[model samples]
Every structure is written in structure tokens, then in C-alpha cells.
Target: MRIKTKGFKKRTSVDEALKILLSHTPLPSIEEIGISRGLNRVLACDILANIDVPPFDRAAMDGYAVRAEDTFGASQTNPIYLKVAGEVKIGEAKEIEVKPNEAIKIATGAPLPKGANAVLMYEYTRELDEEIEVLKPVTPGKNVSFKGEDVKKGEILLKKGRILKPHDIGLLASFGIEKIKVYRRAKVGIISTGDELVNLGEKLSEGKIYESNSYMLASLVKTSNSIPERKGIVKDNKEEIKKAIKEALSNDVIIITGGTSVGKRDLVPEIIAEIGKILVHGISLRPGEPTGFGVIEDKIIFMLPGNPVACFVAFETLIRPMLQKMQGLSLMAYSHYLVAKGILKRKIPSEIGRRDFVRVKFDGKYVEPIRVSGAGILSTLVRADGFVIVPENLEGFEEGEEVEVRLFHNYFPAP
Candidate 1:
């Protein structure tokens, strides 16, 4: 199952690889979905508030509603008494008006009566027979949530291409919006290439290994808000690989794991070059140095390394951004992650022309590296809190150097 050959000679820099990936045309389909199903979906159009958020002037607190001028100059020693007009029940919209020396009972969030302009908390007034005595002075419009205070009618609340979150869903619901238009999730096809690959739960032969890269890639695709379809495994044969790739082109993006490096069984790169143009045959990055990317027709094909760690790195560094672009999300938005500054506990070495992603766990102040000698070690990624990207220009970082650590999904070492 092993092949011996010279390694890839020409390697594309990280920036160049990203540029090539961005060249592919993304899927341009839109679908309307309910707000409940809009989480993580990119908005296809701007969301303008059809009506004001509150829609009407509402009471901001629970108390007696009255004209603010009525309570002016009133103190506990000489309190002004107002007759109880009526109670305005929430959602009932009772037409209660507070004339001079009159008050109406109002609750929080209840629509304010047409003639009332202020609210006096129940604790601030005492019941005197049938009237409540207001012991405090108030200003006009006090405690009144005016109409259009929160949101004006026809105001643009959310812009297009914004990714929906839970808060966004609630905001849409506030306007009684039940459905919205969003960019359709891009469907990606994941194909595992190699005759030595075996499906999970199957008995592993002497040379065959379990096929886990497909699942990993599928998870990555899901994390990127894209749909993933595992197209199963294909052998090293050129025709079979080509056939699989041809079928996968139906998807928005195709990912081929294994058989990307320069080896006798590495037919993915060759087949990709034959069917489409290979944009990047190799990358100047550790763990994922053997990665490849290409375009066929209007679809993007990513050739990732066979090692699970390498495949994960390649997907995060390249494929994730492409998927975001297809979904109308900004590639520059890294809000999902938490970034922190920590001092390196020890020095990390790297080649001059190659970028390295060193996974390290940080205890709020110091970053501890997760040692790994081979890219096939998947535990390194699991144990590490995040990774520090060493640029190609710098050789490495010295101990005690302050480095920006991009945490993995907001995870940080506990104090």
C-alpha cells in the first residue's frame, strides 16, 4: 500500500492557495426558511422592520398611569390624590384616559392609555379610600416607552449576507417575522481515495486502515455551515478515481482525502489535473504541505493529506473559508473563536519557507505546546487548546515571546 517517490517540488504559498480557492464560482441558490430554521444561515436579503418594535407607546413599569403634570409639586406630606379611572389590562388595549386628578392602573409592557403620560410605582403611592395618593413629582413623558422608540418602521435592522444567530432569530420574531430568505447551504461531497481504506466497523486487514478522514471532513463541512455527503471510498486506480470525481462534481465542492502527495498510488493529483486545472499541487505548510486544490467546471476540488491531522488543518485553513464564501458569510469574520495573548512556554522551531501551525494548550498566561512528531497523530489536535500560526517569514518563536493564540471554539484552559 506504500509508494516511494520524491516529494512535491513546487509548493504554493498560503496566500496564493487562498487566492486560487477564491477564484471558484460559488453556488448561487436562495431558499426561504422559517426563522426557527435560520440559525447559522446567511441572510439572502436585508431584513427591514415592517413595523416599529413596540408598535405603540407602552408602559415601562408596573404602577398607576397618570399625566406627568398631575404629580408635579406633590410630596409625601401633602400628596395629591387622583381618582382611579380604570385598569388597562395587558393585550386588551382598554381605552382608559387619565383626566386631571385621575389615574389608571397599568402594568409593564401594557400599551399606554391615550391620555396618560407618566407612571407612578405602586410603592410610591398609597391607597386613600378609592383614590391613590402620588407622593412624588414626575416629568412629562416619564416612564413612557414612546412609539418607535426601539425600532422605527421601515428601518433596516439586519443587512444582507449577515449570518443568523439566536439573537437574530429573536429580533426577527419581535417583528412577527416567521420566515426569511437565506442563501442555501452549500452541499459538499467528501471522497476518501485509496485501496487501503476501510469503512468504520469493518474488520481492519493488515495493511488497510479505517477510513476516518471522510467523517472528519464531514464534521468540518458541517461546522462551516455546509452540507456534507460522504461519497464513500475509491481505490487508487485512475479511472475509478476519475469516475468518483466526476460524480462528485454535482456538489458545490468536492474533497478528496489521501493520494495527494507524489507517490505511485497518488492518483488524485494526476486525475484532477487531467479533468480540471490543478491550482495548487502542494502547500508550504506543515502537516498539510501535501495538500492540493483545483477547479473543474464550476466546482472546487480539494486534495487533502491522508493523515487525519493534516486533513483537519487543510480544511480549516482553506476549505472552511471557501464554504463561508459560498454561504455569503464574510471570510474575515472569525467571531466564533476567542483570541487571547499568551507567552510561549518554550521555543518552537520551523523552516524558513514553511508555515507551521503548532497546537498548544494555554493556561490563560502561558502556552504549552502539544508535542507531535508525525502528522498522523490525531490526539495532538484533541489535547491542544488552540494553535499558533507561525508565518513563513519568521523561523519560529522564542520562549517568553508574546503570541496571539486563536482558541479553538472558545475553549481555554481552566484556572
Candidate 2:
């Protein structure tokens, strides 16, 4: 194969490249799924409450139901006595009435009896056979959970584009909602291409390395709440890569790793341009400058670098947002990553025209930038806690400067 010496004629800015990709992305079709499987799925439509939550006036505590006036002026010095009329347990449907000067035993979450306005705790009353002595005055509506207190009928329980959570599922279950309308998860096809790549469990030859980009990309897809279909590996040959691209067009998005730069072996970009329109072929970003994307048969195709760390950065910076948009979620919906401010332990060097993602280890008090000679060093990502983005306008950050670090894992405890 003849090598091409010409580099990228012009590289697009990171912001412009992302804008182009999102313009071509459309929300996936909606589907009705059971609430049991709705966690992390985006809602297709606003869900309105058909009935009020808690459905009725109920007791918030285990106590005796009685009219407020009946317990008025009751104290330890001068206790008021009332007849014990009946009892109400949780989920019970029997109608019980609290007549004047009478009290009924009620359990927590049980429906408040008719003609009762308040609940006097058992601690304030002494059970004396058929009657009880009230030692504390009770206020109206005390210890009572009124109907629609949690959710009102005809109110919006959840809005469209909301990502369902465990508590959301429980809330839907409270309304007896078996199924909910949610956006369908996007099906992503991942294709890894290179001549020196081999799958796991295969023999390790002198010139071949185990392919890992596909596995890493697949996990990133899952984190975006999408399904990944691994298309396996294809050699650098044109015909083989073309066939793989054609087959992967069935997916909503196609990610081709390796052969994305301007080299003779970088046939993936040429094939993508031949079969479809290459919208953005290069970006002004560190480690992922060769990253590019296009559209084929209405499917978005991403050409990522073979280096594992570069592939990860490209996916997180560009592809992840598009995937989220396809699933009916806002681009910033999953932007709840933990951020911490710390003093820089060392200086970070960068160019002014390119955006740089500097991997750093944040030790609660200081942000230490991890230096790597090349983007192929994937171990740097593992050793670092998170990364800090240096914008294109600025050259770099000085030591001792306070900077915000975006954490890779949000669940990390406070330092």
C-alpha cells in the first residue's frame, strides 16, 4: 500500500464538529416498556398522575383517632376520658366513625376514620378497659396525611426527557402504572480495523497486539444507556473494511476504530467518504485530532484513533453526547459528574489553537497532571482520577493555580 504524506488540510474546532454531529442526530422511536425496566431510560412523554398519591386521608402515625375538641384542655393534672369505639389497621376497608368524646385505635398508614380530625398518640393516653384517658391536647389535622399530599391528580408526575431512576419506578408503581412510554435505546455498532490487531484468546504473535478499543467503546456505549453491537475486527484491506461498514449501517450509529488519520493505511476515512458524506474529518483537540465523523444511510459514523486513550477521549468528548441526544435526553442530562477544586501541583504545557484533555490525579488537596509522551499510553487514564480540560484560547495552567477537575466516577467519596 502506498503511504499518503499529506496531513489534514484543515482541522475543525471541537465545538463546530460537535454542532455538526448533533444536527444530523434524531431522537430514537418511542416504545412502551414496563416500569421494572425503565430505570435510566428517558421518558417519551410527560406522565400525568391519574389519581392522587396516598389516595385518601390516612394516619401518619399509630395513634387514636378522635375529634380535636374532645382532647382539648386534656392534661396530666386534669385528664379527659373518652370511650374506645373501634380500631383501624392498615389496608382495612371497614368504615369506622369517631363520635363525639370517642376515640378509635389507628395504625400508621391506615385510613383516618370518619368524623375524626386528629390523632392523639398512645403515649399521651392511658387505655382503661372500654375508655382512654387523654393527657395531651390534640390539634386538627395532626398526624394526618391528607389525600394528594404527595401528588395531586392531573399533575405532572414526570416530564418528558426525564431519565427514570429507582425512586421514579417506585413512584410509578404507587400509581399502579405497569408500563411507561420511553425512548428506545440506540443500537450502536462498533468496528475495530487494523492489520496488526487480534482478538482475545488468540495466540499473541510478535507483531500483533490484542484488540481492546472495541471492548472499551462498548462499555462507554452502555454507560450512555445505549446497546453496543460489536462487529468484530476487520483488516486494513479496502474491500474488507468496506463490507464491514456496509453491514454496520443498520445500526443507529457506527464507530470505526483505527485507520482514521491521514495515512495510506487509513482507508477507513476514504471508504466512509466514498460511501457517504464525511462531514468533519479532523478536529483541533489533543490526542484525538484524527477523530472524524460522517453520515451513511442516515446512520452516524465515527472514525476514531486506534490508540485506546485517544478513542476514549473522542467518545466522551463527541460521540457520547450524540448518543444521549438520540435517546431523547438533553446533551447535558448526564453532566452530573463530580467536580472538585484543587491547587495544581505542576504546570501543564499545551498549544493555543488546540483543546487539551490533561489526565490528573486529584489527591483532595492537589491536582497532579500525569505526563505521557504519546496518546497510545492507555495506562495514564487508569492511573489518573480524572481530567482537566484546557480550552483552546489558553496555552496552559500554571502550578499552584486552582482548577476544577471533572471526575470520571461520580460516586467517589469526598476527600
Candidate 3:
């Protein structure tokens, strides 16, 4: 095929592009999974308690089950005696009725026997071989965990769209819930394209470099709690790029890095337009202007710039939210990053119409910007701690201005 080169007639703003992308995001399907594997998974439906937690009245402490009236006026000076009915260990189901003036030894978590209205702690009672002396009195229902006290039957335990945590799973287990309905993990396909790219572990030619975009994109997908399928590297040829995209349609989202700009080898946009609809082709964002997205057969397709830094920026600004939406998570949630406010140590320049993601390091006191002219400098991302976003409405931030920094990594260096 003949090569063609073109220029962007118009570019969309970062906000508008993101709006278009999210409007086309499809809802994730639901699947039944065991509670053991539900951590971090989104619930598809509200979890209603089918049965009350602690199913029956049980002992909350190691004590003797008795009637509250029988322990009245019992103290160290004058003790009341009761005949020992039987012993109830934890998880035992023996039926031992506490008759008048009768006490039963009950272990913690053991079911309270019939006719027992309270429990007297062992510390306040003296066991005298078949007869126990009550030194203190307990009110009705004391030291007893009532049925449905923790969770009531037919009550909403957890709401829909909630991200399951370790404690949430434990709560479900307490209710004897072995399996739950959760949204299925979105599968993302990542494809890197370029004739000058070579895979790792292979000999590199003079003009070729090892491909790294797919690996980085795959890791970003994993961070969003989605499955990533690396489609391998494809040359700049139109047929190869088209074929790879066609195969990646099996995934819920397809991310194609490189070959998205308005150049002779940038054939991805043209091909996607031929096969489907291009929602947005160019964005007004620094380091990621070539970022775009489209749809084919209901599967969302993302066109990311080949430059490593540009790829990273586009993923954070655009694709991350899309993945969160796909997995039934809130788009505004940034659980992986820690947000902090710091004063700028120096000024950063930017155009009025474009948004800029300036990488910066925080020294507990001031935020220092890491200067880089090009988007291909991957080392800048590693050297910097986090990034500061300058919105399109502002020209830039001046020195000593307080700005919010989103720390991608856990370690925040102190001054």
C-alpha cells in the first residue's frame, strides 16, 4: 500500500475526549465467584443476608448459663448455689435445659441453652463439684450474643458496586456465603507498532530499539484490576497493524501504541476509521497529543502515542478512567495514588489551550519539577516522584504556588 502523511485539522480538549470515551464504555458482565477470590472485585448486586449472623443465641464469654432472677442478691458475703446441669463446649449442639436454680457451664461461642436468660462469668462464681456458687449478679441477656444482632436476615449487608475488601469477605464468610456475584474483570489487549522496534532478548540493529510500551501498558492494566493481553509488536505496515487490531477485538478494550500520529507510518487511525468510528483522533494535552480512541464491534479501541512518556501520560489521563468504568468502579477514584499539596519551587511554562502533566519530586517542603523536552525520555518518569497537572484554563503555575501532587509510588521523600 502507498504511504500517506497528513496533519491534524482540529484537536479535542482533554476533558471532551475523556467524555467521548466514557460515553462509549460498555458495562461489565457479572460472574459468580467464591468469596475467597472476591477481594478488590466489584459486587454486581446488593448482598442481602439470607440468614441472621450467629444463627442462634450464643455465649459471648466463658461463663455459666443461668436465670437472672436466680443470681439476685448473690455476692461474696452471701452466695447463691445452683446445681450444674451439664457442660456446653464451643460448637456443641447438646440440648441442656436450665431448670429453676440450675446453671450450665458454657464456653465462648457456645449456644445458650433453653430457659437460660443470662450468664454469670466464671470469675464471679465458685465451682463446687456439681454445685456452683454465684458471687455476683448478671442482668437478663448479659454476656449473650443474640441471634441477628450482628446482621439481620433480609437486610442489605453490602450495596451494589462496592469494591470487596478483606473485611468485607470476612463478613460474607460469617453469613455462610461461599460464593458471590461480582463484576467480571475487564480484559485489555495491548498492541505496540513500529518498524524500528525489536523485542527484548533479541539482537538490536543499529536503528532499532527494544519494545517497552506493551509491557508498561500491561502493568497499568493490572493496576486497574483488569486482565492484560499483550498482542506483541507489529511493524508499520498497514496490513500487519490492521490484522493485529482485528484479532484483538476479542478483548473488552484494545490499546494500540505508536502509529497513531499524522505521519506516513501512522496508519492506525486510518485503519480504525475504515473498520469503525473514530471518536477522537487528537487531544490538546502535553506529551500525549497523538492520543485518540474509537470503537469497533462494541469494543473500545485506544490509539496511544509511541513515545514512552507520552504513552504513560495518555494511559493515566484517559485509559485509566476508562478501565475503572469498565470494571464498575468510580471514575473519580484514585486509590493507587496518594494526593498531597506542596508549594512549587520554580515556575513551569505551558500553552493556554493544552493541559500539561509535569513530573515533579516532592521533598516534604517543596515540589521540584523534572525538566524534559521530549516525550521519549522514559528515565524522567523513573527519576521523578509524581506529577502535577496544569489544567487548560491556566497558562502555568508560578513559583511558591500551592499545587496538588499525585504520588504514583508509595515512598514520598522527606526534606
TM-score of each: 0.93, 0.96, 0.94
- What local distance difference test score does each model get? 0.84, 0.88, 0.88
Measured over all alpha carbons after superposition, the RMSD of each candidate to the real structure, in angstroms, is 3.2, 2.5, 3.1
Clashes of 2: 0
- Cα displacement (angstroms), candidate 2, residue 39, comes to 0.6
Off by over 4 Å in 1: 1-7, 333-335, 409-415
What does the lDDT read for residue 73 in candidate 1? 87
Clashing pairs in 1: none
Compared with the true structure, what per-residue lDDT tens digits does model 1 show for residues 94-182?
Answer: 86677988999989989888788888888889987789988897788778899999999999999999878789999999999999999
Going through the candidates in order, what is the number of backbone clashes in each? 0, 0, 0
| Tens digit per residue, CA lDDT, model 2, 1-415 | 2223546768899989989999999857899999999998989999999999789999988989999999999999999999999999999976779999999999999999999988889999998999999999999999999999999999999999898888989999999899999999989999999989999999999999999999999988888889999999999999999999999988889999999998777898788878898898889988899999998998899999999888988998898889888887667522646888999989988888888888899988899999733689888988888888888898899999999898876633110
Q: How good is model 1 by TM-score?
A: 0.93
Superposition error at 225 for model 3 (Å) = 1.6
Question: C-alpha displacement of 251 in model 3, angstroms?
Answer: 1.4
lDDT of 3 at 32: 99
